[model samples]
Target: MTVVTQEAGAPFGAAPPSGDAAIRTRGLTKRFRGGQVAVDTLDLSVPRGSVFGFLGPNGSGKTTTIRMLLGLVTPTAGDYSVLGLPQARALPKVGAVVEGPAFYPYLSGSANLARFDAADPTAPRGTAARRVADALDRVGLSAAAGKRYRNYSLGMRQRLAIAAALLGPRELLVLDEPTNGLDPQGTREVRALVKEIAAEGTTVFVSSHLLAEVEQMCTHAAIMRTGRLVAQGTIASLSAGLAARIRVETPDAAGAARVLAGLGLPDVRAGEREVTAELGGHAPEEVNAALVGEGVAVRGLAVVRPSLEDVFVGLTGEGFDVDG
Candidate 1:
């Protein structure tokens, strides 16, 4: 992955905002009352038009960071930009659902959206009806447009929240825990909706604790631990950073281990009928040839790349809540 650094005369390794980045932060931080640091020095680079997943366990400061980014909360230190512009200048083009969705319990979905659109000074009053309808259709909630907010299902409620964000044209969508507290079907519904939105060229910044959500929906991801970012990159690049392992099943496990060690493979371990070692900068075919040439009968050989869970755990020294 490319490492972006702050401008000259700033912190040595801080990340500066780039023109192509949808969202960028350099040393962004947040500290609450009574000396609680909710967010540490954070440098984030979210490329434009990419579905970026902000991942971490609960209370890792994901929401606080999002609040600071949206200018809802002031950061104690550092600077950030949205859509290449300062927060206040860019919020008109950005839509967000932070924390959770809230609507008048007695109001219908369409009514609630109409009220929201009317409240936006930039939204044209004459286009209110059309925009409300379009936003409902975009989130697949047109069927439930007239349903009361209190009568809507959990999934419908979440979709309504997303619809509210889409009441006007948005270049970026920031969703915090969009799939939180949802069942399997609800989770899938929200996941598909997010992809559909991204497909239309909107930059999506999703804050989620569910690993499965990030793995399936996001093209790029940034992981946090204890209020600090640990890793950030495309999913493939993050996974590639971990070494792939070569596994060989053979009756002569000891001989296979010896051959693999002789070939300079690290972590060579011989089990009852298998030998495994990290395939660092070495081809699997080369390892296989060396094993066969050394009189080791290789029954099976396979290269296993590390999973996303492995990569995150390795970086943060903590496992994620992958219930989804």
Candidate 2:
């Protein structure tokens, strides 16, 4: 694995700065009345064309930071840019579903999307109907385009909200908790739609509290804790710093442990039928050969890698609401 040099004073696991970031921030912050700091000074970089997951538990300032980025909320301090342009200039090319999806219950899905497209001064009136149709199709809602918003399923409703965001050509799409409050099927539908959108070369910024959602949908992720970014990088790179372990299942556990310890593997622990050790800079083949040479019967051997959950807990000192 390639080593990434940390920027001076950056939080643990932060990726080095990139020149082609779709979104970048320097000292971004937000403080509400009563001196409650919703978001602390944050430096973020999201690479262009990457599906970036902005993740944290509830009340960890994820939403506040997003609001500041979208200009819906003013930051107490710091600066940010979207698509290499200032917020105001970037807004026209950006589509976002913030907080949650809201629509008139009486309006059909297509009707709601048409209304939204008409409200955009940058959208061409001549392409209104085509845009609406295309947006509905993009979100897999064309079959139910005429369904009343009140009658749409939770998943369909979420798709309609995404359709609204796609009413015009967008360079970037921001979705905040797009799968929140949905059933398993709904969550899957939204996840698939997000992947499809990203496949078409749009940069997607997803703010989610669910670990599974980010793990499955995002190409890159940034973890937040207590209003501060704790880690940021490609999913693979984020976990690369952690050590993997090797497990040997055998009756001669003590013999296996001794061989692993002799090979300089750390944390060698022997159980009745198993021996495990951290496999830092050591090859599993060499360890296996050494064990066999020592006459230890190896029933099973496996390399256990650090998961995203492990990375999260290591960085935050807390577990996440993994499935939510």
Candidate 3:
């Protein structure tokens, strides 16, 4: 699918989204009280039907950027567009929540969605109802359609929020910390649902501190540090910047180093009982076979690639709770 991703100098919600580019932002900036720069000049693009993960550490401006994109907080500088609408006037088309999604405690899930339909006359009721039903089913919340919001668990409420976001037949769905309170099973379910939605040509722009989750679910990603975009690209391309790590659990570190030197792998470093270095096109199986052939008992061998969390840490010079 053609993706209409973020472009330079494009106003928020202006110009038709071409080639499946669902969301785009350029020079986006946001500042809060006390001179805290919540978001600095940042550029981003999300392709239609793409599961795009926005990754960063806490206070890295992930939430601030989402807020600006949804128009809840205006950017101090730069331009943005969502679903082909200019940010200046795209309020009617965008559906998002920067923080947690709020709902009436007394209202049932279906009733809340119906209320949304009533509020947005532009959303066709028949279409909205169908979308709501589909979303509920997708999120595994169909059984709780009649239950009040207050009775729903945290995960269920989050799913309801996702349903509400899907209610207007939106082509682009933006979520912040979507898996915040979900259990592992609920997280997997939501991740699968996100992929399914993206498969149907709807863009999914989601943010989270957990890089592992993003690595598993997202096709493309952007990394932010202290309100600035430090890295962005496909996973493979990003990994190319970091050195490949090889882990060998051997009783003889010196002997392994000598053997690796014979193999001519560059920048080999030895530590207590383990050695790491860039693998110059040699597969793990090949390395293990070579070691075993040399009478070196290879207890275990594993290749460690730079994870999305690793990328975030490399770019930010810091680390936080990355394994959500």
Candidate 4:
């Protein structure tokens, strides 16, 4: 890890924005004592105000990267700049919920938030209550502010951790598997909260294993495999090059396959009632017309677009662990 110098580091009170990338890393790497390469030489660029999904299967170094971004763990090599300046200097502008934030179980939500907010000495001396109240409200926990932390459900606890991150103005919010262990309803709630946070113009960086959720919620994404960055781009851009497939079901499936094969279609497969082939930029209209011209009546037809999960599997060769 490159040593952070006095000139490059600043306190939480550093001046307003200085860069375009909310987070940028060059050759960021980490390795434990046992020689486990959790993260390899990575170059990541998170655009400002984007709901960026950091995706990977479990143990793909998502958490380690977040830890390094939040300064919870130091990298064994490389360097990164957050919010346009050296990370140490730009932390106040960044908020994060890394792993499960440990809250005092005996304390009420409001009380716990007050304590956490108080630790940020840069914050004003007199507005603790208001800040805590606003933070809890932001995460939709206003009604449960007075409830003891121990009594909260897993979802509620997760939101509280996010509330804690919102104690003050934040330009960037990094969440690592924000919905890791929640039920479907809880997952929906957290995902909704994430959208709201992004709507407020904050750059939300979410590291999750839920491909569908990421596909639905994130504006941009970066996919990881093993310990390296595999793919990164706007969801549309990343998927734009993925070929679609055409599937048609008909009584004359075998004939249809023969026709498609004669027409130079590749990977044509004929089953009981369906003939499918890799579209490879071939138009569905072209396939449909050809089938009809060949006297094959199309019963059902579809052009299947590849999903994020498809992209993930293709890129990483692993099934996304939604629970991860």
Local distance difference test values of all predictions, in order: 0.83, 0.82, 0.75, 0.81
Per-residue lDDT, model 3, residue 174, is: 82
Q: Which has the higher lDDT value, candidate number 1 or candidate number 4?
A: 1
- Model 2 misplaced regions, further than 4 Å: 1-19, 183-185, 319-324
- Candidate 1, residues 164-268, lDDT tens digits: the string is 988888999999988866778878878998898899999999998787778899999888777777778788877776778999999999899999999999888
Candidate 3 wrongly placed segments (more than 4 Å) = 1-20, 88-94, 126-131, 282-297, 317-324
Which segments of candidate 1 are over 4 A away from where they belong?
1-17, 318-324
Give lDDT tens digits, candidate 2, residues 175-229: 9998877788878888998898899889999998787778889989888777878
Over 126-165, each residue of candidate 4 has an lDDT whose tens digit, in order, gives 8888989998987789999999999998888888998888
TM-score of 4: 0.89
**Top-lDDT candidate index:** 1
Candidate 1, position 129, lDDT:
91
Error of 3 at 90 (Å): 4.8
Q: lDDT tens digits, residues 89-193, model 3? A: 455455664577689999999888788767775776667778777767767889999999989999898888888777765677788988888899988887887
Give the range of the ten consecutive residues with the poorest summed lDDT in model 2: 1-10
Each candidate: RMSD: 4.5, 4.2, 5.8, 7.2
Measured against the true structure, the TM-scores of the candidates, in listed sequence, are: 0.88, 0.89, 0.83, 0.89
What is the clash tally of candidate 2?
0
Top-down lDDT ranking: 1, 2, 4, 3
Off by over 4 Å in 4: 1-18, 318-324
